[model samples]
Target: MANLDTALKDAMSIDGAIGVALVDYTSGMTLGVAGGTPEIDLTVAAAGNTDVVRAKMRTIEMLKLNDDIEDMLITLGGQYHIIRPLTGPTGKGLFLYLMLSKARSNLALARHQLRTIEEQLEL
Candidate 1:
Protein backbone atom coordinates (compact mmCIF):
# COMPACT_ATOMS: atom_id res chain seq x y z
CA MET A 1 0.00 0.00 0.00
CA ALA A 2 1.15 3.51 -0.71
CA ASN A 3 1.16 6.36 1.78
CA LEU A 4 0.34 9.93 0.76
CA ASP A 5 3.96 10.76 -0.03
CA THR A 6 4.43 7.60 -2.02
CA ALA A 7 1.18 8.07 -3.87
CA LEU A 8 2.01 11.64 -4.74
CA LYS A 9 5.39 10.59 -6.07
CA ASP A 10 3.76 7.81 -8.04
CA ALA A 11 1.32 10.28 -9.56
CA MET A 12 4.18 12.53 -10.64
CA SER A 13 5.69 9.62 -12.52
CA ILE A 14 2.77 9.38 -14.91
CA ASP A 15 3.54 10.28 -18.47
CA GLY A 16 2.97 13.98 -19.11
CA ALA A 17 1.99 14.64 -15.53
CA ILE A 18 2.34 18.27 -14.59
CA GLY A 19 0.78 18.13 -11.14
CA VAL A 20 -1.36 16.06 -8.83
CA ALA A 21 -3.29 16.63 -5.59
CA LEU A 22 -5.57 14.91 -3.15
CA VAL A 23 -8.42 17.17 -2.13
CA ASP A 24 -11.45 17.23 0.09
CA TYR A 25 -14.53 17.93 -1.94
CA THR A 26 -16.63 18.90 1.04
CA SER A 27 -14.25 21.60 2.23
CA GLY A 28 -12.40 22.37 -0.99
CA MET A 29 -9.13 21.84 0.82
CA THR A 30 -6.10 19.95 -0.38
CA LEU A 31 -4.84 17.04 1.69
CA GLY A 32 -1.70 16.43 -0.35
CA VAL A 33 -0.11 17.75 -3.52
CA ALA A 34 2.90 17.31 -5.80
CA GLY A 35 4.56 18.42 -9.07
CA GLY A 36 2.86 21.72 -9.86
CA THR A 37 4.55 24.24 -12.11
CA PRO A 38 5.09 27.86 -11.17
CA GLU A 39 2.24 28.89 -13.42
CA ILE A 40 -0.12 26.45 -11.80
CA ASP A 41 -0.97 26.49 -8.15
CA LEU A 42 -2.24 23.00 -7.35
CA THR A 43 -3.95 24.15 -4.14
CA VAL A 44 -6.10 26.58 -6.04
CA ALA A 45 -6.78 24.08 -8.75
CA ALA A 46 -7.83 21.43 -6.29
CA ALA A 47 -10.16 23.80 -4.46
CA GLY A 48 -11.80 24.90 -7.67
CA ASN A 49 -12.23 21.37 -8.89
CA THR A 50 -13.99 20.55 -5.64
CA ASP A 51 -16.87 22.65 -6.83
CA VAL A 52 -16.96 20.75 -10.08
CA VAL A 53 -17.25 17.46 -8.27
CA ARG A 54 -19.92 18.77 -5.92
CA ALA A 55 -21.96 20.19 -8.75
CA LYS A 56 -21.85 16.95 -10.69
CA MET A 57 -22.78 14.92 -7.65
CA ARG A 58 -25.63 17.25 -6.86
CA THR A 59 -26.88 16.96 -10.41
CA ILE A 60 -26.74 13.24 -10.21
CA GLU A 61 -28.77 13.21 -7.05
CA MET A 62 -31.28 15.68 -8.41
CA LEU A 63 -31.80 13.58 -11.51
CA LYS A 64 -32.00 10.41 -9.47
CA LEU A 65 -29.50 8.73 -11.77
CA ASN A 66 -28.61 6.13 -9.10
CA ASP A 67 -25.05 6.28 -10.31
CA ASP A 68 -21.63 7.24 -9.11
CA ILE A 69 -19.00 9.41 -10.74
CA GLU A 70 -15.79 7.62 -11.56
CA ASP A 71 -13.86 10.63 -12.75
CA MET A 72 -14.13 13.97 -14.52
CA LEU A 73 -11.96 14.95 -17.46
CA ILE A 74 -11.44 18.51 -18.53
CA THR A 75 -9.45 19.08 -21.70
CA LEU A 76 -7.97 22.47 -22.22
CA GLY A 77 -5.91 23.75 -25.14
CA GLY A 78 -2.71 22.35 -23.68
CA GLN A 79 -3.75 20.37 -20.65
CA TYR A 80 -5.83 17.45 -19.55
CA HIS A 81 -7.22 17.64 -16.03
CA ILE A 82 -8.49 14.52 -14.36
CA ILE A 83 -10.54 14.52 -11.15
CA ARG A 84 -11.26 11.22 -9.50
CA PRO A 85 -13.25 10.97 -6.27
CA LEU A 86 -12.07 8.36 -3.82
CA THR A 87 -14.77 5.88 -2.73
CA GLY A 88 -13.31 3.78 0.03
CA PRO A 89 -14.51 4.17 3.63
CA THR A 90 -11.59 6.31 4.71
CA GLY A 91 -11.35 7.97 1.34
CA LYS A 92 -14.89 9.25 1.17
CA GLY A 93 -15.24 12.94 0.38
CA LEU A 94 -11.68 12.99 -0.94
CA PHE A 95 -10.47 13.08 -4.55
CA LEU A 96 -7.39 12.86 -6.68
CA TYR A 97 -6.66 15.52 -9.28
CA LEU A 98 -4.10 15.04 -11.99
CA MET A 99 -2.86 17.46 -14.62
CA LEU A 100 -1.24 16.23 -17.81
CA SER A 101 0.19 17.76 -20.92
CA LYS A 102 -2.32 17.07 -23.64
CA ALA A 103 0.34 16.69 -26.25
CA ARG A 104 2.16 14.01 -24.31
CA SER A 105 -0.46 12.19 -22.28
CA ASN A 106 -2.32 9.05 -23.21
CA LEU A 107 -5.73 9.72 -21.69
CA ALA A 108 -6.77 6.09 -21.59
CA LEU A 109 -3.54 4.95 -20.01
CA ALA A 110 -3.47 7.79 -17.52
CA ARG A 111 -7.00 7.01 -16.39
CA HIS A 112 -6.18 3.33 -15.97
CA GLN A 113 -2.99 4.04 -14.09
CA LEU A 114 -4.70 6.51 -11.81
CA ARG A 115 -7.28 3.91 -10.96
CA THR A 116 -4.53 1.53 -9.96
CA ILE A 117 -2.90 4.16 -7.84
CA GLU A 118 -6.17 4.93 -6.13
CA GLU A 119 -6.63 1.28 -5.26
CA GLN A 120 -3.18 1.01 -3.79
CA LEU A 121 -3.34 4.29 -1.90
CA GLU A 122 -3.48 3.91 1.86
CA LEU A 123 -5.63 6.54 3.47
Candidate 2:
Protein backbone atom coordinates (compact mmCIF):
# COMPACT_ATOMS: atom_id res chain seq x y z
CA MET A 1 0.00 0.00 0.00
CA ALA A 2 1.19 3.47 -0.81
CA ASN A 3 1.47 6.12 1.84
CA LEU A 4 0.47 9.74 1.32
CA ASP A 5 3.83 10.77 -0.07
CA THR A 6 3.94 7.87 -2.47
CA ALA A 7 0.43 8.50 -3.65
CA LEU A 8 1.26 12.12 -4.36
CA LYS A 9 4.38 11.15 -6.27
CA ASP A 10 2.38 8.65 -8.25
CA ALA A 11 -0.06 11.38 -9.18
CA MET A 12 2.70 13.63 -10.41
CA SER A 13 3.93 10.86 -12.69
CA ILE A 14 0.71 11.06 -14.67
CA ASP A 15 1.04 12.59 -18.10
CA GLY A 16 0.43 16.35 -18.08
CA ALA A 17 0.00 16.52 -14.35
CA ILE A 18 0.63 20.04 -13.16
CA GLY A 19 -0.27 19.61 -9.52
CA VAL A 20 -2.03 17.26 -7.14
CA ALA A 21 -3.26 17.64 -3.58
CA LEU A 22 -5.12 15.84 -0.84
CA VAL A 23 -7.64 18.28 0.58
CA ASP A 24 -10.25 18.25 3.28
CA TYR A 25 -13.42 19.73 1.88
CA THR A 26 -15.00 20.07 5.29
CA SER A 27 -12.42 22.61 6.35
CA GLY A 28 -10.96 23.73 3.03
CA MET A 29 -7.49 22.69 4.05
CA THR A 30 -4.78 20.70 2.27
CA LEU A 31 -3.13 17.67 3.78
CA GLY A 32 -0.52 17.20 1.05
CA VAL A 33 0.58 18.73 -2.26
CA ALA A 34 2.89 18.03 -5.19
CA GLY A 35 4.00 19.18 -8.66
CA GLY A 36 2.67 22.75 -8.82
CA THR A 37 4.28 25.23 -11.16
CA PRO A 38 5.56 28.57 -9.97
CA GLU A 39 2.53 30.24 -11.47
CA ILE A 40 0.19 27.98 -9.57
CA ASP A 41 -0.10 28.01 -5.83
CA LEU A 42 -1.38 24.50 -5.10
CA THR A 43 -2.35 25.25 -1.51
CA VAL A 44 -4.68 28.04 -2.57
CA ALA A 45 -5.99 26.08 -5.51
CA ALA A 46 -6.74 23.07 -3.35
CA ALA A 47 -8.53 25.25 -0.81
CA GLY A 48 -10.71 26.82 -3.51
CA ASN A 49 -11.60 23.46 -4.97
CA THR A 50 -12.84 22.45 -1.54
CA ASP A 51 -15.79 24.74 -2.10
CA VAL A 52 -16.51 23.05 -5.40
CA VAL A 53 -16.69 19.65 -3.76
CA ARG A 54 -18.84 20.86 -0.88
CA ALA A 55 -21.24 22.63 -3.22
CA LYS A 56 -21.75 19.59 -5.38
CA MET A 57 -22.29 17.40 -2.34
CA ARG A 58 -24.81 19.87 -0.98
CA THR A 59 -26.63 19.93 -4.29
CA ILE A 60 -26.75 16.16 -4.37
CA GLU A 61 -28.27 16.07 -0.89
CA MET A 62 -30.76 18.83 -1.63
CA LEU A 63 -31.93 17.13 -4.78
CA LYS A 64 -32.32 13.81 -2.99
CA LEU A 65 -30.36 12.15 -5.76
CA ASN A 66 -29.63 9.14 -3.54
CA ASP A 67 -26.26 9.12 -5.20
CA ASP A 68 -22.68 9.95 -4.51
CA ILE A 69 -20.33 12.07 -6.53
CA GLU A 70 -17.60 9.99 -8.09
CA ASP A 71 -15.78 12.93 -9.47
CA MET A 72 -16.12 16.56 -10.47
CA LEU A 73 -14.44 18.10 -13.51
CA ILE A 74 -13.78 21.73 -14.24
CA THR A 75 -12.40 22.67 -17.64
CA LEU A 76 -10.53 25.86 -18.32
CA GLY A 77 -8.88 27.15 -21.48
CA GLY A 78 -5.60 25.42 -20.71
CA GLN A 79 -6.24 23.27 -17.70
CA TYR A 80 -8.39 20.44 -16.49
CA HIS A 81 -9.17 20.18 -12.81
CA ILE A 82 -10.32 16.91 -11.32
CA ILE A 83 -11.76 16.60 -7.82
CA ARG A 84 -12.32 13.08 -6.54
CA PRO A 85 -13.68 12.76 -3.03
CA LEU A 86 -11.99 9.90 -1.23
CA THR A 87 -14.23 6.96 -0.39
CA GLY A 88 -12.14 5.09 2.16
CA PRO A 89 -13.06 5.35 5.83
CA THR A 90 -9.82 7.18 6.60
CA GLY A 91 -10.51 9.53 3.75
CA LYS A 92 -13.98 10.74 4.57
CA GLY A 93 -14.40 14.47 3.97
CA LEU A 94 -11.14 14.46 2.04
CA PHE A 95 -10.43 14.39 -1.69
CA LEU A 96 -7.76 14.14 -4.33
CA TYR A 97 -7.47 17.22 -6.48
CA LEU A 98 -5.58 16.97 -9.75
CA MET A 99 -4.68 19.68 -12.21
CA LEU A 100 -3.60 18.66 -15.68
CA SER A 101 -2.48 20.40 -18.80
CA LYS A 102 -5.32 20.08 -21.29
CA ALA A 103 -3.00 19.97 -24.24
CA ARG A 104 -1.05 17.03 -22.86
CA SER A 105 -3.51 15.11 -20.73
CA ASN A 106 -5.85 12.37 -21.77
CA LEU A 107 -8.82 12.93 -19.51
CA ALA A 108 -9.99 9.34 -19.48
CA LEU A 109 -6.54 7.98 -18.73
CA ALA A 110 -5.85 10.54 -16.05
CA ARG A 111 -9.08 9.66 -14.30
CA HIS A 112 -8.30 6.00 -14.47
CA GLN A 113 -4.77 6.49 -13.21
CA LEU A 114 -5.98 8.63 -10.38
CA ARG A 115 -8.45 5.94 -9.39
CA THR A 116 -5.66 3.40 -9.27
CA ILE A 117 -3.61 5.68 -7.10
CA GLU A 118 -6.55 6.18 -4.81
CA GLU A 119 -7.03 2.47 -4.44
CA GLN A 120 -3.45 1.92 -3.44
CA LEU A 121 -3.26 4.90 -1.15
CA GLU A 122 -2.98 3.97 2.53
CA LEU A 123 -3.86 7.54 3.55
Candidate 3:
Protein backbone atom coordinates (compact mmCIF):
# COMPACT_ATOMS: atom_id res chain seq x y z
CA MET A 1 0.00 0.00 0.00
CA ALA A 2 1.14 3.54 -0.60
CA ASN A 3 1.67 6.02 2.20
CA LEU A 4 0.06 9.48 2.21
CA ASP A 5 2.99 11.23 0.55
CA THR A 6 3.23 8.70 -2.23
CA ALA A 7 -0.51 8.69 -2.77
CA LEU A 8 -0.56 12.45 -3.06
CA LYS A 9 2.30 12.36 -5.52
CA ASP A 10 0.51 9.70 -7.52
CA ALA A 11 -2.53 11.91 -7.65
CA MET A 12 -0.46 14.82 -8.88
CA SER A 13 0.79 12.70 -11.74
CA ILE A 14 -2.61 12.63 -13.37
CA ASP A 15 -2.88 14.38 -16.71
CA GLY A 16 -4.31 17.68 -15.56
CA ALA A 17 -4.14 17.51 -11.81
CA ILE A 18 -3.77 20.96 -10.35
CA GLY A 19 -3.99 19.92 -6.72
CA VAL A 20 -5.04 17.08 -4.46
CA ALA A 21 -5.77 16.62 -0.81
CA LEU A 22 -6.85 13.99 1.69
CA VAL A 23 -9.42 15.57 3.92
CA ASP A 24 -11.43 14.65 7.00
CA TYR A 25 -14.96 15.85 6.44
CA THR A 26 -16.09 15.41 10.01
CA SER A 27 -13.56 17.94 11.27
CA GLY A 28 -12.96 19.91 8.08
CA MET A 29 -9.25 19.24 8.36
CA THR A 30 -6.73 18.42 5.66
CA LEU A 31 -4.70 15.36 6.59
CA GLY A 32 -2.41 15.61 3.56
CA VAL A 33 -2.07 17.70 0.41
CA ALA A 34 0.01 18.12 -2.75
CA GLY A 35 0.42 20.20 -5.93
CA GLY A 36 -1.34 23.50 -5.46
CA THR A 37 -0.63 26.81 -7.15
CA PRO A 38 -0.76 30.32 -5.75
CA GLU A 39 -4.21 30.75 -7.20
CA ILE A 40 -5.49 27.75 -5.32
CA ASP A 41 -4.87 26.78 -1.76
CA LEU A 42 -5.44 23.04 -1.46
CA THR A 43 -5.92 23.09 2.29
CA VAL A 44 -8.63 25.72 2.17
CA ALA A 45 -10.30 24.07 -0.78
CA ALA A 46 -10.31 20.74 1.01
CA ALA A 47 -11.82 22.26 4.13
CA GLY A 48 -14.54 23.99 2.15
CA ASN A 49 -15.42 20.78 0.41
CA THR A 50 -16.01 19.17 3.77
CA ASP A 51 -19.23 21.13 3.86
CA VAL A 52 -20.18 19.74 0.48
CA VAL A 53 -19.67 16.19 1.65
CA ARG A 54 -21.47 16.75 4.93
CA ALA A 55 -24.43 18.35 3.24
CA LYS A 56 -24.83 15.59 0.72
CA MET A 57 -24.52 12.91 3.39
CA ARG A 58 -27.06 14.64 5.55
CA THR A 59 -29.42 14.94 2.63
CA ILE A 60 -29.03 11.29 1.85
CA GLU A 61 -29.76 10.33 5.44
CA MET A 62 -32.78 12.58 5.65
CA LEU A 63 -34.17 11.21 2.43
CA LYS A 64 -33.48 7.66 3.62
CA LEU A 65 -31.57 6.74 0.48
CA ASN A 66 -30.06 3.31 0.88
CA ASP A 67 -27.39 3.99 -1.70
CA ASP A 68 -23.97 5.34 -0.85
CA ILE A 69 -22.25 8.07 -2.81
CA GLU A 70 -19.46 6.94 -5.10
CA ASP A 71 -18.20 10.44 -5.59
CA MET A 72 -19.19 14.05 -6.12
CA LEU A 73 -18.20 16.14 -9.09
CA ILE A 74 -18.20 19.88 -9.41
CA THR A 75 -17.47 21.21 -12.85
CA LEU A 76 -16.27 24.74 -13.25
CA GLY A 77 -15.67 26.77 -16.41
CA GLY A 78 -12.03 25.71 -16.52
CA GLN A 79 -11.69 23.21 -13.77
CA TYR A 80 -13.09 19.96 -12.42
CA HIS A 81 -13.34 19.22 -8.74
CA ILE A 82 -13.68 15.64 -7.61
CA ILE A 83 -14.50 14.53 -4.12
CA ARG A 84 -14.29 10.81 -3.48
CA PRO A 85 -14.85 9.40 -0.03
CA LEU A 86 -12.46 6.57 0.74
CA THR A 87 -13.95 3.10 1.04
CA GLY A 88 -11.00 1.06 2.23
CA PRO A 89 -10.64 -0.28 5.77
CA THR A 90 -8.05 2.32 6.68
CA GLY A 91 -9.78 5.21 4.93
CA LYS A 92 -12.85 5.64 7.01
CA GLY A 93 -14.01 9.23 7.45
CA LEU A 94 -11.53 10.52 4.94
CA PHE A 95 -11.86 11.64 1.33
CA LEU A 96 -9.64 12.24 -1.68
CA TYR A 97 -10.13 15.67 -3.25
CA LEU A 98 -8.69 16.37 -6.65
CA MET A 99 -8.75 19.49 -8.79
CA LEU A 100 -8.00 19.30 -12.46
CA SER A 101 -7.81 21.51 -15.47
CA LYS A 102 -10.83 20.49 -17.51
CA ALA A 103 -9.20 21.23 -20.82
CA ARG A 104 -6.36 18.85 -20.12
CA SER A 105 -8.15 16.19 -18.12
CA ASN A 106 -10.14 13.17 -19.10
CA LEU A 107 -12.91 12.73 -16.55
CA ALA A 108 -13.26 8.99 -17.06
CA LEU A 109 -9.56 8.36 -16.64
CA ALA A 110 -9.31 10.67 -13.67
CA ARG A 111 -12.12 8.83 -11.91
CA HIS A 112 -10.51 5.49 -12.60
CA GLN A 113 -7.14 6.71 -11.37
CA LEU A 114 -8.72 8.07 -8.20
CA ARG A 115 -10.35 4.71 -7.54
CA THR A 116 -7.05 2.93 -7.94
CA ILE A 117 -5.39 5.44 -5.65
CA GLU A 118 -8.12 4.92 -3.09
CA GLU A 119 -7.54 1.18 -3.08
CA GLN A 120 -3.80 1.49 -2.57
CA LEU A 121 -3.77 4.38 -0.16
CA GLU A 122 -2.70 3.45 3.38
CA LEU A 123 -4.09 6.54 5.09
Off by over 4 Å in 2: none
Give all TM-scores, in the order shown.
Answer: 0.97, 0.97, 0.97
What is the descending lDDT order? 1, 3, 2
Best first by TM-score, ranked: 1, 2, 3
Candidate 3 local lDDT, 19-104, one digit each (tens): 99999988989999999999889888988899999999999999999777799999999999999999988889999999999999
- The lDDT of model 1 is 0.93
Off by over 4 Å in 3: none
> Would you list the C-alpha lDDT of every candidate in the order shown?
0.93, 0.92, 0.93
Residue pair clashes in candidate 3: none
Considering every candidate listed, which one attains the maximal TM-score? 1
lDDT (Cα, tens digit) per residue for candidate 2, span 1-123 = 899999999999999999999998888889999999998999999878887888888999999999999988899999999988888888888999999999999999999999999888877
> What is the clash count for each candidate, in the order shown?
0, 0, 0
lDDT of 1 by residue, 22-111 (tens): 999889999999999999999999888988999999999999999999999999999999988887778989999999999998999999
Model 2: lDDT of residue 75: 97
